[model samples]
Target: MKKFIALVSVFAAVLLVGCAPEVGSDKWCENMKNKEKGDWTANEVRDFAKHCVFK
Candidate 1:
């Protein structure tokens, strides 16, 4: 049981780390702003680069 729990914890940690967004990029800043405005969504952020002004 302990080994199973440890494995699950490690898996969860890896998943959390993998899901973290890249910081300092324009997409990151836009995501932060959207979160502050309560309009953040993963899909919306994913599409941001399509309409990004930075090219």
Candidate 2:
């Protein structure tokens, strides 16, 4: 039960983080720039390039 709750919590957190502002929007670009490069996952980096950097 404890493990299940922890897993659910992690899933919720991931879901929330993935709910970023729309790609290419000002807020999305701002977030992409401000996030620490070391902290970015592969998907996040890709998104940054596809949306923020390329824009």
Instruction: Give Cα-based local distance difference scores for all models.
Output: 0.67, 0.86
Poorest 10 consecutive residues of model 1 by lDDT? 46-55
Candidate 1 structure quality by residue, lDDT tens digits, 1-55: 9999999999999999888676546766676666654575676555554455435
> Candidate 2, after superposition: displacement of residue 45 in Å?
0.6
Model 1 residue 50 CA deviation (Å) reads 24
Candidate 1's error at 25, in angstroms?
Answer: 2.0
TM-score of every model versus the real structure: 0.47, 0.55
Clashing pairs in 2: none
Off by over 4 Å in 2: 1-19
RMSD of 2: 3.3
lDDT of 1 at 10: 100
The true-versus-predicted C-alpha distance at residue 4 of model 1, in Å, is 0.7
Tens digits of per-residue lDDT for model 2 on 1-55?
Answer: 9999999999999999799688678898798788888998888888888887776
Instruction: State the lDDT at 16 in candidate 1.
Output: 97
